[model samples]
Target chain A: MNWMRTEMERPGQREQFQDALLRGDRPAVEEMIRQELADYPYWRDELLGELTEQYLEGAVPFSQLTVLAEAAAALAEHLPPVAVCGSLEGNPGDTGRNFIQMLFRAWGVPTLDLGADVPADHFLDAVSGQGIRFVIAAAFSADDAGAAMLLHQKAMERGIRDQFDLLICGAKLTEETGKKLQLACMDHRAAAVARWVVQTWKNR
Target chain B: MEKQMIFPANRFALVPDRDEVFAWLQCDAGPCRAAFEREWVPALQLLEETMTPVAVCAQRNANALTVFLTIGKETEKRVSALFQEERYILGSLLNTLCDEMLFQMDSKLANILQRELVSEHLYMAERLEPRVHLSPETLQADFGSLQSMVPFARVTTSGVLYPAKSMLYRIVLTGESRTVSALHDCARCDQADCLYRNRKHESLREKEKLPERELKESTKRRKRLVWREEIGIPVLLSSNASVDDNSEVSRFMDYFKLADPNDAAYGALSDRVHLLTC
Candidate 1:
């Protein structure tokens, strides 16, 4: 649908969407969203990306942002379920993990959220018990990174490194670390990772 | 004996820089820019009315500088409540902005130290440790007493800072003759958080002693390591402030009535008005 082109052509469409969402004009927002989905379903990721940007900018409240995320998730409901879980230490906020989950859901991949402060063994448990082959780990501070890296090492120790694909996202997932771990590192945006997941799944 | 000094909220301006805030909003684009202009004022007003910046500077021992910072009790309460209400995104953004504002204030403080105190080099506490000779665990343990310097901040049982929005730093001053290296070589390090820690790299030498087939497999797995550009939004350290329902910014939705919410200019004007009222 050439989402960028459409966004460029209709300069204020995103703002309109955000204003309607903020003003509690759900019907109007829903109608606009429906139109976009019906006409350019391929641009679902881009549309959600714009909404996430608004939420990050504080233009939309958390409730409204969740609603948008759910809406995006509903669009890709037909896709297969892909087990996903994330854990962060010390940080109570789960916005990054939630956003990634929503993006995965939008791509029709059902995610199993393990919540925060997850230990390395829990990730291995998910893979072994749930038959899930993909795992995502996130860390904000050095402490959180310590826990996340522990998870990576545990996965390796348990002989699951080659069995499952570990995707690390967050401030601590540097290029050097990703290279050393032999895992994929995602950008902060859920859309970017979702795109990678979609392409990888399709290619596979 | 350890020494500490408290800086009142008035000592530093906690308001965010206009350009940085706009940049954060990604307002350079046409649509987002229009929305930013509309919403900027009210957000600024809310910030000014609610925020009270406070800082504490202390030296745990003779060599290290520790600073504890927060935007006072009221804002912390407000942000905490927002999180409880499940307005996590808004709460997170405000929390992050406050941290950035504190950092700006810290930079100013550094400038003052360099100009007035004539310090040669100022090293940020987080930057200095783990990269230098000191470990975070050691510093975190040593600076445990500094928590009492600030009223709103505390150290958790895990030795991590609490009131997640609050910042605790331990900057150090060195003579010009000393060359400080902030970057850590993660590949060689055993630090758990070191992203560059190559588990296989360390074991490769040991694996060389294994059978040819096992070594071949190990080498193949190592060869698969590909570096991709690090992506993702920088994670802000989460603040664990308790929620307060009486937050002044809770009714933030009512502060601005977009005269034609769809109109870019109108939205911009409304935001400017909100900022102006502050």
Candidate 2:
């Protein structure tokens, strides 16, 4: 190899080459940045999260919002379907539910979402009556699980257990108790859960 | 096909025919479409309560639509009576009814939609409000837009939206393609560690490995690797490796590329090959 070519093969060369691809302003190299990031395993989550945070903060375009939403939905479909119920007041989980719903659509799973602040009876009624494959009971605070448990119990009582499957996920299912209940423990990484579920379900 | 609610703020309109539903949604006059959508709420209210499929139709040029619900003859009659002399309020009444009806839904049926792909978008609105009208002529000219609105998700016909969710994209060889499919449950997988494995594929030895504290946890794990019975028959759905199954899934996966012209994943299965599997 030529000495100069070998010299150009140093660690910094990749970054320099990437930088050289940009040629000038940092802002103009977004496409190059995207291409470079595409194959990076961690890039999808980081880019998605940044874009999501920006959109939620009202700093991103609606088109970008849709892209983020679609990616999230694709991820959400792989996991067990969860339904979160809570008052919108001071509860960010409800917002998370909306984001997940949009993401599920993007990922190609049709989601029937009943919005937040829903009455526990109504929630139970759906749990009792519909063949919900999974019931994702979400409560932002400690007190929320009471209602979720009641709904879960109601499903059992109504014989809804035979028809559908239920998976409770959220802030309320503490790690310690999650193990107790034998519920699938999921981290706040929504996309990760979604992807795992899809992969798991497919392999299953 | 049954209409399923996939996410929050999700709405489904059951018209006698999908074209008419799209046509009404596309009307230029905001109130005209609003009046129509508003009128359908009561009917939806009834259908949701009865927990059955519904078909709604409008009288020619009458701002009113007739709803024929199939929860049962008696329940439909009662619902019709509720609508006969009742004054309708758009949001409040519908919202309240939705709350009540959602409670009455058959959890099992709802669960089916949750577990299975149930709908496709026949039409999707790029923007909301002003009702966003696409007349019959427009739909015929570009019937494709209505395809997205199908109750099912992620189905494309010639890039046009269709209302079926029984398909998925699969990868063959190197490229990605779409296929009309029902995935086999992981319970059927030959691989023991297949993560998707649920109860249907559980092994007795694996069960014995759980610690005392983990017994309940083990029961909660989902089953894995079992393909739907229909998938095994090539006639019902083209086998993943079949020549006739040229769906978007085949095109997507391009199994041709995976062929390697030289067997790679299954050298043992190929007599001429020498790859080993332990």
Best by lDDT: 1
Docking class of 1: incorrect
* Cα lDDT of model 2 by residue, B129-191, tens digit: 000111122222232222233322222211111111011111011112223222232322222
DockQ agreement of candidate 2 with the native complex: 0.01
lDDT of each: 0.51, 0.33
Model 1: residues with Cα > 4 Å off, grouped in runs: A1-29, A33-40, A46-85, A89-115, A122-133, A141-146, A152-164, A171-191, A201-204, B8-11, B37-52, B60-64, B72-96, B107-134, B150-167, B171-278
What is candidate 1's lDDT per residue for A65-111, written digit by digit as tens?
44444334434443334566675555443545655665566455666
Candidate 2: which stretches are off by over 4 Å?
A1-66, A70-93, A162-165, A169-172, A200-204, B1-278
- In order, what are the TM-scores of chain A for the candidates? 0.64, 0.50
lDDT (tens digit, per residue) of candidate 2 on A1-204: 011221123355344423322122223333333343322223334454554556446454323333233223322223334332232222222323543444444443444566554554565666555534444444443334555556556656776644543444334445555554445534333343344443444444
lDDT of 1 by residue, B82-137 (tens): 54443433454455456557556665555543442235244332223221223345
TM-scores, each model vs. reference: 0.52, 0.27
Candidate 2 chain B — worst ten consecutive residues by lDDT sum?
Answer: B123-132
* Candidate closest to the true structure, highest TM-score: 1
Q: Score the docking of each candidate (DockQ).
A: 0.04, 0.01
TM-score of 1: 0.52
* Model no. 1, DockQ: 0.04
